[model samples]
Target: MDRRLRSILKELIQAKKALTSKFIANINQVTPRTTQEDIKKLNQQLLSHGASIQSIKGRGYHLHIEDEQLFRHFLTTALYENKDQKQIPNTPDQRVRYIIQKLLLTMDYLKLEDLADEMYISKATIQNDMKLVREHLSNFYLDIRVKPNYGIRIIGEEMKIRFCMAEYLIQRGSDSNGNIYDGFIRLPKEQTDFIKQTIIAHLEKQHMTLSDIAIQNLFIHIAIAVLRIQNGHPVDNDANPKQEITHTKEYKVAEKIVGDTEQELGVIFPPTETSYVALHLLGTKILTTADIEKNQDIESLLDPAIYELVIAILDRIELEMHLNIRHDRDLMINLGLHLKPAMNRYKYGMNIRNPMLESIKKNYQLAFQAAVHAGVVIEKYTEVTIDENEIAYLALHIGAAMERQKLKQGPKRCLIVCASGMGTSQLIYYRLKTKFNGKMDIAGTTEYYRLSTYPLDDIDFIITTIPIHEDLGIPVVEVNAIISKDDLQHISSYIAGTPSNVIRDFLQEDYLFLNQSFHAKEDVLAFMVSEIESDDLKRARFLESIYEREKIAPTAFGNLVAIPHPLTPQSQQTFISIATLTEPIPWTTERTVQFVLLLSVKKNSVEDLQPLYEMISKLIEHPESLQKLMQMTDKASFMSMMETLERL
Candidate 1:
């Protein structure tokens, strides 16, 4: 019962088709031999649950379950409750079937003698395993056909065979000690030897050490990744969009080793199962920082944003360690420096000893600001936190900064201008409108027919998508018919030169309202509970208790709106009920609040605070609009009106 196997079977059942061994092998990175065995074991296990595996003469296997819903429930009950552990049902026959299916996936046709050797039992025991497999298949025409040449192959309907196989392997397997790791390793002697040789050969290049057990575990990781990827599961490592050649090559080498080992041991590491184990092993081994830098070409392969983050981190580490610390360079020293102090502080049971170290590493925001101030080459988030209307202004600043830094940004917003009266202006406006989506905002498409007309105010930059008869007293880039990228690039250079002192000053003003008025426990609770029905009295009492321990800080968030809530909570769920003042009540002894949001939650569930904060921020984005919403005569009307407004 491998986790990956269970997942793959579930995916197959969802897909409603019998997948080929070739597809499963490619995903699992197992050899054709191993896949066949895995399918056989899966079939044997499925029989106990009124399931069967059938193999169409030339086609691959498919699983047939008598009760799909019941099977899913049984699986959920068995696996989901304690998802991290690897425990199948209590039936001995089911357990035997599980082991046999896993072995089948690793070998083509495991002989009775080979099975006996691996299981530490006699020939009779090996035969009994097969007997249980057949008993499970008694309901169907499916039979384990034996050949002097091929050994054993399941024969029957393709759909049933594949379904049973997928169901068995989709679960995570349990070790003798009940540990779960992706999938289990059930390798024969030759295959095990070959895998070790392949691993040793590759590790020699890096001079790394890995035990035999580590090698098998490495294979299991790869096998799981391959299977998950094929079944459309999101893998943590696969998020990296880079093409890893050295890593991929190493996996190929592992596959070859497995094949060679299987041949030597007179076991089958069929072609279907080889690649998954190899790639998975290769990928997992290089997860360390040194390995990634050494093997991965991030500069050439990764996105600029990601690459900059990596460089920024490395630069910080290099500055501290006095070492270049390239991607591939050993990071053990730096990692140790960070981890040892934390471990020591915890071991000694003291919190105050590591103040300076924590200050440098803990404040990530300050660290980023430090990096920016130090002239470190990096990309900044283009859209800074500002008013919705101010986004266009911020965009101009971003364009300017990108130009100054010689960086590229897509889609330029252009302002078109002309004299107030003509057909020429209308013509340019129509063409530009048809050409670009409002990505290019025509601040004002003016007329050439009139000389002195409408005033063009607050135009950051302009692009005349058409030629002008007069200069129009502004920097203009003339285009023949359509606006070219080159024109936008030229405009970007000019826009970058505009003064940013005004925007910077606005940001520096500190618009955030800090500690304001604190409300009484009973008064606020009565206010909050007034909005809900009497049936929700328990909820009101809970909010009262939350307020008793933690005070509600009411901020006069300007524009006549006030959001009231305790910083921490002690409720089961986040109650986002609203309160409105009949009269404009002076909230902070200065500003008044007509609208308020009372956020209350249980103290232990501190994490729920963020969503309420964000929702409140979005609600108060437009103060004037909110003031209008709050003035509604009825509570139901106000609630109805508030529901229509979108949260950021």
Candidate 2:
């Protein structure tokens, strides 16, 4: 089968829902007609394979299996056919990924002609792909060295080579056992399963818990270590040992796991290998509240340095973002415990794969940004650069603290008022409770006639089935007898502290700068600072703080948007200043900025800034909106776009 057909079949096999023709075309980078033709060709070929593509009316296409055994056999044969005869990668992106995996798996130098022939591409295409391969390998500290008249080979530290191999060779989001036999550098499924079961059994016996992703990470580590050791590349024995890791109970558990793995796999592991396994254990352990409760002296279990490091991280986050999570004891303890093993991993140059890294970044943008700030402090102290995966794990802890803060603030107090009889009132009350259970607290249900007599001191809002005419300080939201999606949205907006008219309240015409000429980022900062009507010292300090924050990490979060702020509050009042450049300026190597949001928060202010952050994050995510706002020549048009984004 051709690559397009193979790609289509794979998508159908893996899809949980019917896939539209356009979706498949987008994935294959082809037109709908081409996808249809490929589907027809695939179905014709699948006739004898006991599988066929079934097209659903108004929906899309799905895979139908007539004979499971035959389909499985056919899939195995198609996937593992002769490498040279197999379909070539159809796209440059696919070829780049393929080249990386191929180079990481093969020890011998590969000629450009051979790779081009194998992938059924020209030598020029192969050379172009090599450029991307070299760039990708550089991230892992590996370089592609070309020997004249020979070929190109990857050269780097052995540890780094192995780390790159572990990253590229294994397929992500695979099964739970971390098996990679189907990919390049195949490992025996039985051995991988044995190692996974052994690790789980030992961890359970020691009363330790690890997330599935962490377990998968450890499984991959042990599997790769065993393979490398068998290939005569054991970890260096001369490296200094970590006394703290070797003394922990986790080390003993690692010892048992390595012993069983060695016996079962018929390989000898050095003491250093045991320590390496222990490092994974230390790095991946999840400290739950139950674990802390079971051991009253949980704080004593961690290294003193690790505890202090966590404190310093939270302090930096508080100082930089004003997140107010420094005093969250649970967050502090959990983050401290997590850092201990993480530091060990960093010391040994080990990378822990986080499958949820992208999801974490998307869903917990604020937390992830704060964690990035925390990561800068960690790197300053530890002298080791942290990867996005590790930063994502840190974001998990911080995101939990943010959630706990919301819970601690308690739910919004609202009184439900219904003018109808008791049955209607009861119905509305139960419906609201069911939908907004944890988010809202029902003060009590009362008829409109008795609403005046009822105490409203603690009420934050009044939910009424009829229009409320009484002038009460609290806002009244009117809804139908039965709640609706729109009603829920209104309640959610209130809960999020985003009033419909709130954006205009914060964004001022004076603060909005349109079509500015700025060549450098520093120039832009200076311009923004000069616009702020503050003392000269404060303006200078704010600019310096913005530079400091930029040093921690560039605030250019892609999509032609950048939100630059000071490391700490530099103003007595909070405000936002906006600027749009005539041309995009280089904010960072990977990002360009035309839209700039300079945020200034009040010192010691505890107001919720989530609504403003959400609005900015939305603009950052949607470049079309940014483009639309950029074209606007006045503040009125800009505020209109902001209103549209806020509704979204």
Candidate 3:
């Protein structure tokens, strides 16, 4: 079964009711027609397994299991195990991953046609996927070599190959739903488990600390080394480079780990491989003193440079982002601790995977943005580009500080006005009191005619039943006299200024361009920059800064959304210029983008932009809203979508 088909089957098995093809298509980022065809193919595979996907017209597809035992066996054995013959690749991305993993596992060549046959895909589809595979490998300085009469094999340095394997194999042992991929590691399940437990036991015995992710990475390096050595692909230098690491603390533990695994498995590890293992240990090791009392001065415990990095990062965040977290001592300590191992990983050119990257980017937008700035500062200080995975890790510490900073934030002060009478005003006031419950501080109630008597400067907003056309230097939400539940829900989005008029504040129709015909990233950016030519933007510097930012990290946030921002504040006003492409273009090697959001922050301006980033992140993940946004040709439809979304 194709991975997408596996995904469909997984969803159907778990769902209590039938699901629409459109719904499934949205989830898989495919068309309804494609989803329907996949469902048909899935039904054929499931029928013999005692379950079939049955389509009900006007309703959707439903899973019907005729024999529970057979279906359970199929689900348990085929879906979750490395049943190579039963699993096939259909999607382009799936095929690319499959081809890479196969080459990495076999470490030898196989014919193209055989690979296509194994995948149950066309020779042409495999060829197309190879282009992407080659590009992906190049990032690690690896390549695929094909010779006459001999099949293609991945050709690269052993270290780079191991790095690639770590990314593709061990890191993806199970997906977010805990659904294990078929043979995520090349070794036998028992051997894999043995290696993991061995590493853990030795680390615990030595009182050395490693995060689960770091442990998994170390496990992959060991597993790869074992597999390579058994295949007679010895990297040599078993004794040549072993001298430097012979006396280290990590070397001792690595020796014990390798010795035990060798003893149990009846094999021997090369001296160089043992030293290599120690290097990984050095790259991933964390301080065991994290559990020490917080009252102990952190600066005294940390290296002076590590202390300087943390304080500098916090100070930069406060000065540039206006977040009051520089004084957070706990944040400083935690950040300092994380950066120590993180810097070592960078020094060793080792990858640190953050499984929570997307969630942090989406839910902790303000913190994520702060982390991006911190990443920039770190790049200047440490001379390493902090990737999204690393930034996500930093965001966790910043996010906690943002929560602590919230203690100083007070509630919005709102005043209620009723045109009907005092009875209606009191009723509206009490209703808000029940719904908000300290979310807002309602000063008092008043009749509409006498609303001018109350001081206007202090009030954040006025909740009124009567229409107030004049601008009173603050927002006014005019709700119906009989406030319905729907009304309250609509009011909830804007009431306490938590959402903070994000849409109305930043988005202007003049800055929006719909269905633009651009084929490349540069063309789209140049066109948007040209359309919004202004003295405030400082066009040349703005474009240069945007490109610089892109070079630091790919701006594509996935699901067709790409946010391009300047390296530093380039304008006097914070503004967003949005452009939707007629067709999606490859914005980065790994991602294509159709929706482009060009954002600029004002120089030296202090504004809370948390809601803006959060809403944008939510919109990026929401296919329905993103689809509408891309399709919208007029401002009315765009506003309508926001209004409808506000209600939801």
Candidate 4:
């Protein structure tokens, strides 16, 4: 099968629900008609395998498996066949990446004609690909220049060239079983193994717990450094001469690791090389609970400024996102510990490569956004711009805390007040218990007459069979004596509370701006701010805060969505003003945002906005809904669709 077919199959396999033709087309950057044809051809190929694509009229296409073993075998064989059958680049983007990788791997000048011949493309096509190659290399601060007699060569600082090689030259290796191999540099397997084992032994001795991906990243860095040094390209000593790094314990550890490798591999590394490895150690070490000594104060162990900064970040996150993770002491310590070395990296302009950045962004978007907020705080204090990779690492710390909070929250406690006799109440109780399972904790049952004498102090809400018109301090959900699916849904609605309720309450018709023609993010923000009925000073401050947040990181969350908000609350009342552009506007280099949700919280407000943010995140996840919202010409249709979507 072709690359596009494989891409479609992968998308179908990974999708949680059936993927629409439009969604698949968007992903493949093609028209729906073209995608449909591709799907038809893919289905033809799958007939020999054990899977087929089922098209649902007016819905989408779903992948059906007839035999799992056969399907798995087919996938393996197909992948192996593709691997063995090396072919030239067939697309412009692929050709660009190919040229970039080729140029980065070789030190000598590469002839344009040679590249054209290798890819079986014309010289003009090769020239166009080189233009893209230069554009991509510019991001790494590398330049591609052509000599009069010689061909094109990549010229840059040695360290930058190494960084580019680390990013582009080596292939992201994987095994036959689809396992990713860490040895990417062109070193012998035994040598790579020796370096990895050396680092592992020393890390174990120091009781440091770096993640697998972190270990692999460190291994790759050291391997590349060794290869580059052997080729007479040592890192410049004057790049960053922070004497404090030499005094740190990680520096000593790095020295020992490099010393052992140098003896084994017969290559000598300078003091700067040791410091470079130590910087990696400092940035990637995962803090275990054992790191904190018993009865030792965390604040005393961490830098005072970082500790305070972490606290401030948590406070701001709680105030804005209302994640309820401010009291997570473990999170505070982790963030503080991470910030110490991260601050060092930022101070010296060191880059820490995060291999799991893409996965983290896709899987933990809400947490990533919260981390972006944290990054803003870091930028304010450190006066350094934090990249997405660093922001993603911070997100991991915050995501873990959010997960811990979920595991610690137990379940919702509710009391069942059935008007029927004990027998019927018992039936209802068993049904709810079986349905909700671990999601709910039953606080026992009681009859309506006995409810007045029952203790309601420990209950979060009351589930009753019949309506009781009495004032209670908790929410009461009414259902039938025998719980039906609709009754359970009603209880669920009461329990989770459809985010549409919050959206409807906060998103007023006057505040909603649909199909607005704005070319830039600033224009969109200014228009949205003007629409808000607030004082001039507060409006100006709010606009300034939006720009300040943008400087730290753009608010574009991808999927054609951008949620722009101030760093802090700037209004007397919290509200969300939404503006959907007629055409997608550039919010960032990688993201063109069509839907902009401008959020402003009430000043000094303690209200929980988690549901509001959750709703926005949910909307971001559904591209179909975004497309539908963008197509809506009137507010009524948009509101109706939003309400329907919230229930789904």
Candidate 5:
């Protein structure tokens, strides 16, 4: 099959929903007729392989497989048939990544028409891609330099080029184990393995060892250096080589490794390249508690400044979120060790890829938020904007600490709430205490008026008979004052953090805007922000905060959904203002969003918002859910749909 037909077939096979011809054409940059013809041709080829394309009347094209085993065998064969060849990217997303990597690797200028010819695409399609290309490059202060007849090449600081290369060339081609494979590089495995073994042997000889990931990173940089130097693109000698690093153990090891590799690969090692290798060693030098055994604690092992930065970050998180993990020694040790190298990355402008970023965001929402605040504090120390990838790495450490905190917490601690604990609230409190004595910790009873000022630092939730108008930085379960059987069961479910009862707390009808028309992300954000701050004054300059987070990283997490919010909490009460656009609006360079979920959380709220974020993450991963959500026209149906989201 041809590239275009194979592309369409792959889309249909991988699609969770039927693939629309228009959507297929938009990605391939072809006419609807061309897409239809391609699908028809693909179907003809798949018939003998036990699959066919079934086009529905009003919906779209779906793939029907007659024999799953046979079809899958064929797919596996086809998938690996071109393993040894360079793949011409089939879809827009693939093409953009390919273009970026190709340009980053190419030291010479590339003509648009030549690239178009190589990818089997029109010049117009590739040109349209360049707009996004330029936007991505601008983040790293890199841009395309086009000469009249010489064509275009990426032009920027050489260091920026290397940073971009580390991401696109090295990081992008990694496998599930975080191993850098030979996807874009032409170097053979024998040569790459030699480089890896050389570094490991030298490091081991020096009584220093790096993790598998760090070793893999070193191999990629060294491999790329060989290729680039062979192509006359050596690291510019003056690009900030530290003399201080030259005296360190990492430098001596790097120097010996370079000497051995020069003999094996038949290439001379430059002094600048040796320093570059040493710099990477310093940036990736992770020390665990096991590595620092002289003292039982690791505070003495880490740099004082980096250790202090970790304390500053923990102090800020405790002050804002009040999770009381500021004194977590494991968390402090890990974060301090991480920041020492992390600051090295920032000082030298290095980019490290976290393969588990999306999973970290989805599974650890609260921890991710805490890490974002930690990144804010890091900015004060490093004077450089922290990247989302870095924040996600920090989230892993914070999430582990949070789990440790959870294990120590026995029963859910909460308050018995009603009109007043002095009145019927006392009766409800006594009833709750008698009904569930050991399963829950009834700290005391609280009144609705005093809920805001009440110290809810370690409180798990509140059992209230009457409704609480605002979020009191704690979860509230609205049970009957008399405390019936069903109410007790509901409270138990909430104590378990099931959240089937608390989801409605976020889906207020006043904040729901359905089927709105928005042509751009700014319009969608402005509409949601205006509705959120209509009567509420706590979220002043809310839009700027949202943009501040976006400037760090775009929140459009694909699959037609976007969850945007301030980097830090802007409201005293946690709430959500949602908007469903009439059509998909361009939200980020790579994604268009039809569902906008503006999430705001109280700074010190102990409520588990994971279920809410899980529902949104489900929307991002499952296209059918987003389509159903975008088709809804009223708040009732929307809430009804959300009610069934936890099961997803």
Candidate 6:
């Protein structure tokens, strides 16, 4: 196939969508009939190469690559090498032959005309090209067959195919074992014998202690270091040559990677020695007329310690599990693309769906909005498939924002009141601080009876463990000592905001009750039960019983947050109740609970609990939203407020 035509087909494959006949027409706009003929020819060629072309009756053609995994296997072994290879100098015909060989390794069949166009030659020229490919590659018994009207095909022994590939890669200046030691001279006879003896002794117990290629690369490195020292360069203590070395950015990258590798592997690799070897192989004097860094910058970053550690790890895996992790970029990238999220969750000590996930969630709706506003239309090449994971991510973000708004509503100064002097008072103080953190300036702890007598000049809010009878000229939030981290975070969120002093305005001395409703459940609970199913509520109530027992330790996990959860499953239904206090009350000594969510879980289903927790955690974040919610009198209004909060 011609080089130009091959490039065109490859581009189409990457496009990921169907091509219109018009699109193909545009590609060969100058000569429509000729291009049509070319397309037919390319299709035939593809079939011969163990691949096929899918042509929509009305639409255009698409390449259907077969045996993709086999193709990758072939490419890895055939086109690439584990180490460096010499750059082959040859004629253009040789280069063309090399290109054809490498392309075949892709295992993607191409049309003859397309191949001809890629090579920028005529059909006759392609025929000649094929003759040369056959003449040289004949010993490998690789057949390059042309099916005139169909296309062309190359067939042969898979092993020989790989050998041809290795040859092509070496000729193309690829790093392979064959030429790894090209520039390095042999060590002194005694030194050489000693090195071999040492390697043999080390490998006696393991037949594959080191690959033939690895040993050769190691020798090259050592030999290059020796040559640099012998050539009158300043010799370091380690017998490495040191010249007028300047640390460029690339070298800095090398230094950083080397340091990381050394720490991880626990071995010291002298920079001077590595630098000499690198310079000998890739330096300006050896391979090029002018000095320039090439592809091997990454290779130079390999410290001996890290390299050896990697080898050792690979060796163990092969021995113990019989699993080989290909060190190639494509394989590693594919693996990493899958493993990164798992690793991130593990390191951060977060659940799969973390409450804080909202902060980092991608707002696709917002993105679409922006795109439309900017008059930009997305030209999707592939089918627009919905990603469930992405939806979950967005949901997490929304949940986090809801939780944040709850924390943003509290005032700076708050006074903690309780019947007990320092014991309960101190617990209240600590809990408030845990929730509000830098946001709250706790006035002090005092008895509720002291409120009228005590100066209330700077107290923005008052929190009490026990209910008070007299109007204290401040908003008083009564709470139980045992509170969850979720509730505390919600309360801290409210205390952080500058909501109106409803305590001073709404509380009447006559309305004050010592044992006034500590928890207002009539309306809010009704609202939850109305919105959520009966089963959900029952599950939530069951979960709450477990939480009651586990109240032995407060769930105040700092950041002005508390997670009120049942320790075990006992409920038939689950519902979350969110409460934001005007002032944060003492839930416990370890944390405070101003915002309380009673989780009633049913069926002990982890799946059901995930969504409930996700939603509650997200909702507790908004201070203004919670305050608005608290002020709502009707169910409809509250639901509307929730909807608005969800929009946020």
Clashing pairs in 4: none
Q: Is candidate 3 or candidate 4 better by TM-score?
A: 3
lDDT of each: 0.43, 0.79, 0.77, 0.77, 0.77, 0.42
Query: 394-415, model 6: which lDDT tens digit per residue?
Result: 2333334334434544545877
What does candidate 1's lDDT look like per residue over 1-648, in tens digits?
654356446544543345556445533444567777877777676667666667756445567788776677667653454543544422234445655465435434546666456556667766766776675543233577676855665555432333244334434333333232323433343443454555567666654444344454454443333333334432233222223333465556655555554455544433434443443343223245564556545454434543454455456433432222234322322222222222222222212111122122222212222222122221132221111112222222222332333333334445665543356567667766665554455666654443246464544345554466564444455554344566445444344442212112111112211122324324544545554443534655556544532221224454445544442343443355555544444453324455555545433331212223434554555443354454455544554445444322
lDDT, candidate 6, at 295: 33
Q: Write the per-residue lDDT of candidate 5 for residues 1-648, one digit (tens) a residue.
A: 546776677667767778677666644556778899888888887899988899987677889999999899888766445433577777676787788888987867988888899889998899998998998898789999998888889998776776677777764545433344335755666677788778888887876757665676677778778877777777777775757687887788889999999999999878988988887777456664566665665568778898788888999998777776898888988898777777777877777767677777766777887898898899998798888888998998998998898787788898876784486877887787887788799888877777777888888787887887675655677877777899988877776667754457776888899999979999888878777644554445678888888877677775567789987677766888889877677787777777888988765666666567766667666554556677788789888877776566
The TM-score values for the models, in the order shown, are 0.22, 0.66, 0.78, 0.74, 0.87, 0.20
Give a tens-digit lDDT track for model 4, residues 1-648.
766788788877765567778667655555789899999999998888999999988668889999999999998876546443444565565677677777766777989998899889999878877777887788678899898667998898877887777676444543312222222235666787788899999999987777665677677778888888888888888885537678888888999999999999999998888887888777556555566756368787677898889988898788767777998888888888778768767776666677677667666766887898888778777788788888888999999998898687767799999877889989999999998898789999998888899988888788898988886756677889878898888777655544326667688889999999999998989989987876633778889998877766567776678888887777767788889887766675445778898888766554545566667767767765766687678999888887666655
Could you tell me the TM-score of candidate 1?
Answer: 0.22
List, residue by residue over 372-469, the lDDT tens digit for candidate 2. Answer: 88888899999998878888888999999998987777788999999888998898888888888998899889999898899998887889999987
- Compare candidates 1 and 4 on TM-score and give the better one: 4
By TM-score: ranked, best first: 5, 3, 4, 2, 1, 6
**In model 1, what is the error at residue 192, expressed in angstroms?**
4.7
- Top candidate when judged by lDDT against the true structure: 2
Locate the minimum summed-lDDT window of 10 residues in model 3: 173-182
Enumerate residue pairs that collide in model 5.
Answer: none
Question: On a 0 to 100 scale, what is the lDDT of residue 430 in model 2?
Answer: 86
**RMSD to true structure for each model, in Å:** 28.0, 9.2, 6.0, 6.8, 3.8, 26.7
For candidate 2, give the lDDT of residue 535. Answer: 60
Once fitted onto the true fold, the runs of candidate 3 whose alpha carbons sit more than 4 angstroms away are 7-35, 39-86, 120-125, 171-185, 235-245, 283-295, 408-497
Candidate that beats the other on lDDT, 1 or 4, i.e. the better one: 4
Overlapping backbone residue pairs in candidate 4 total 0
Native-vs-model 6 lDDT? 0.42
